[model samples]
Target: MWLTGLLAAAALVLTAPRWLPARVVALRAKVFAKVNGDNAITFPNAQVGPERFQEVYGHPAANGRSRGAALSDLFWYWLSPGAEVHQEHLEAGPRYDDVARTTRALLSGPADELADAAARCAGRVLDELVTGRVTPVRLRDLMVPVWAEYCYELVFGEPCPRAARDLIAGHADDVVTALKCTGLRHPARRERLTRYLARRVAAGDVRRPLPASLSPAERVHYLQGTFFNTAVVQLSEAMAHLLLALAQHPEVADRLRRDPADDRYFAHVLDETLRLYPLFGIAHRITTGEIDLGGGTTFPEGTVLCFSYPDYHAAGHRDPGVFDPDRWARVPARAAHHIPFGVAANRPCPAWRLSPLALRAATAEVLRRFTLHSTVTHTRSLPNRGPCLLVRADGPPPRHLAALGAFLRVRDRWEDVWRSVVQLVLGTVMVLHARRLRLAGRYFETHDTAGCPPGHRPPDHRERAE
Candidate 1:
């Protein structure tokens, strides 16, 4: 009879959500409607374009390169798993140091005993192209002309008397042709590259091919390369989101500017920002096992469902209406539940640690050098969040800038002191909680009682008749 009652109770618990108060459903529907409407208003004609894939130069170039390096480092760390590779090499090194060094000497060096001058020249040309600083006309310019010189240097262990330059002055087209035909597809990407490579290849250019000694498979492997382009794109989107948020909430930017180096504070601001304006508002998963998520929602095997991150964040958070980090500050460590990236059990961003760390580092550095003050007005009368800050980079001292300098410095210092105070307070509370827990454990062990131990009552106990 007891088991029957328990089973019935469980059934009610499962079905309770479907029978939830109408208010809850209406609230969720309203929020979803607003979100969709905002998306349409902001990006009605959103679609990927050809120029999106092409590289940018100058400041954009510098920014992209920085993001690319971070991405490369993160990828290598992910691939190696246990290898404690430094981020710098993961960003720039061709491969593991030993292998990269050997390849450089053979395919990229001036060493007469390595490979040949052509290979070396080709390496230089490709290096420039990959960096997006220069463009080349042909493949031999990179492979034949450069490889021959490198090979001669490797075989004889001495500088070739022949000038490696003229070996392919007019043969640049051949090298470009090989690069275009190599491998990898993305119609837009291919189209842009073909214009550069095909024009030269059509001019009857000739240069050394990757040494006939290399097996076809090996040659293909040599051509297959890794790039940080994906990382660059992701980082750019993240930056755009962050900038937009900051523009909307100038006060948060001001707070962060006060103590830019405090990783904890920076993290809190980012968390709140993400909660309010998540980059990925939803994530989906195919269930593999039976699990009960309270209210009649028993997810069975192979069931596909999408988890609304923004909605979950709103529901689990203390005060969903406000963009306040103080709410996060108040959540008990064990009960904390904000999933800007995704849920803790299954994060959408597998590279969470690295990506956030890179972002924090870059933001901290930028804040250190400049005080970003903006006067840009946000788009009002819409649910969409965006920032329009007129950014001004200010620093150091001048006679007229004295007052502004003092204000900025004071603002930064106050944030530092405030964070230290909060940490001290939290530390005290944690120590008190630990002491209480230990004492309670000892009392229970001695008294041999289960549940709430007899008469050393819980705090806020009610008086009873004697």
Candidate 2:
């Protein structure tokens, strides 16, 4: 009777997935939040909804990058090598000004020239991958190499050398894989690129000069952190989300595949893709000064504001969960609860203008050569790396997608059980290391400053009041 009771309990526990998947996911997130204790005001609450997203985001005082925060430590840990010097993380100062100017120069050129270069690189990438078979592929893996070469050419003003491409891909893949928590950080992989970048800097091979204030080693770290790491990883992830959407919606793929010239429709698809799976899950800011939100409600200095991009994009939209590109036809993308590039007043993405143009060209190149199809589970956190089948444009349609999809549902759910545990363990260790090392904290506490770090900049009325 004891054995019988034990066996019945085991069976019921095994069958809990049917009813407990959502609970498991929620519990996993709860564990993460507990591990990385935050002190921030989350957006989309009753106090701040989509209507005020831009107003709060664009507020002059809400521009602090990383100071007095716990979550910033995790971000710094993920983007090591030179997270402190990365433009996105740097406090507002002369150094940041110089770096931002240089970034603009690198992305500067004739619009047609930049667009054509992206297409050429993307076309070459397709040449190496496309075969006349319904081959299964990981979409992120495919796009990383493509963006690596594109960024290489932008920096070096030449076609990317084979060796450099491999180093870039290695470091970028390791960084992003670790970021997604599907893998661990292999420091050796990141260091190899660091050494390679040092050589390139020594050779004076950069197309544009980096900031003069930065040392040779700092310059190498800057190149590695910015062009190689963030630029490559973000574009690769963005393209993966876009392609996965097209794969799931064959009708949309057919329309774009048949008419590559339809820029209007293609733009709509990009808008909706960004809306559903925003690249940034949460963009946190440290309050440099008090923000008076009217009605006697205000956020004081040093407070953290965590902007929820996914939640904001879902607000004020009908059928927000559906991936219908046609919705952009009725609602102007500007008026919609969309901030893919972020508010202009704050630190909008440096590549804001160039990214869309390059993405549109890349999407056209991909659809021109192949028709995409996938039945894998798509989510904001695509830990499975977006499994899909790529069929040549002329190839016959494949079969057994329904079976593939069914298998994916079961596999992904089970994988989540193990993945959540891994994330919990890894996230705790990384967060602890970040806190102990005090990368950003050290900078804030020690960097030379008369009153406050000049990097933090422009004190407001609250400072004078104090």
Candidate 3:
């Protein structure tokens, strides 16, 4: 009996690697279903390849299709009703050459310098908002130019050209004109930029193929789009959500203000905010070949797969639909899995590092100078629709109240630790029990070989013994 038990244990240990992956996959699918319900997976018509998948929403696309058609419609509807005519000229999809260059520049810069630059930009914007007496100032409009200028400087090693700056800051028509001048058909505009880029390259400042195989015109459009998407669109949306969250959760705000340098705390706030309102809600993907997604579901090659960050995070989160930053402390693993920018493995945005730095710097600066207190209104915008923040600048709250907030935060952290410890223990027990059951089953299966009646032993077993 002892020998049989020992053999059973060995068998269970040896086979674990074979079964572990299936168990994990099943568990993930079960959890997904529990939080997102049965209709979590959707098949849209548009073929958004891996390169472009990072840009789509996780939710179902419009007209009961994938977001591909909807995005194409939006581009034409908003930018130019005649986009079809220039469709041949447009780069097949988002080009990453310039994005790579900008990211490299940002990463090479000193962290402190980047943080200081972001803070200064935020400071300048705050000053304008306060002193301009601009009632209900369009926060989006104000943030766009500031961030665009910063990004332009990073890429060009200088301030944005006066003409480009004027065009970007001007009315809607001017913005349209600026976009048009960046097309291949515009020789004068294209030639001017080509000359500028040539000079930058000659000075050993910018890299060769300054635009990376793209005509000067297309390069300008690509750079402008990339900056606007990352800085103007996503960053503004994230900032708006942060302000809204602060207004909604004053306790969080109080705690954040108490220790402005605590990057971890700020990160938790940002993580929770993004979880509640992810900038890019859904990420689209396509399978390269036949793939099994557990639960007997198999996706053939070319199938469109959409994964929602909100749904994925909410499923694992303690309370899927609540605004709780404290949860991050309790479930650090889940917090770590948070992908507000994009998936870590897949083509994550090159600006992943710089974006967070900017956010943290801007957040710290804002918390120091102002007190936010208001909700926001939602709008219909593709990719992201940051709330309209109605905020006002006020002096910091009392130090005593902040101290109380700090104490509560510490108490919360302790509670989180306790909960996590309990969970670990429970999980360990479950795993041990499962192992015991598997060992018992293995023991029974080999019982015949271990001991059998003299004549009842199978011929193969008797021969082996001989």
- Using TM-score as the measure, which candidate wins? 2
TM-score of each: 0.36, 0.91, 0.56
Sort the candidates on TM-score, descending order.
2, 3, 1
Query: Which pairs clash inside model 2?
Result: 92-455
TM-score for predicted model 3 compared with the true structure:
0.56
Ranking 1 against 2 by TM-score, winner: 2
- TM-score, cand. 1 vs. native: 0.36
Per-model lDDT: 0.35, 0.82, 0.48
Is candidate 2 or 3 superior in TM-score?
A: 2
| Top candidate, metric lDDT | 2
> Which lDDT tens digits does candidate 2 get at residues 379-450?
887766777777777656668656766776677667766766676577556666767887777766866421
Against the true structure, candidate 2 reaches a TM-score of 0.91
Point out where model 1 deviates above 4 Å.
Answer: 1-187, 190-230, 289-296, 332-334, 368-387, 395-466
Worst-scoring 10-residue span by lDDT in model 2: 449-458
Model 1, residue 201: C-alpha shift (Å): 22
Evaluate model 1: give its lDDT. Answer: 0.35
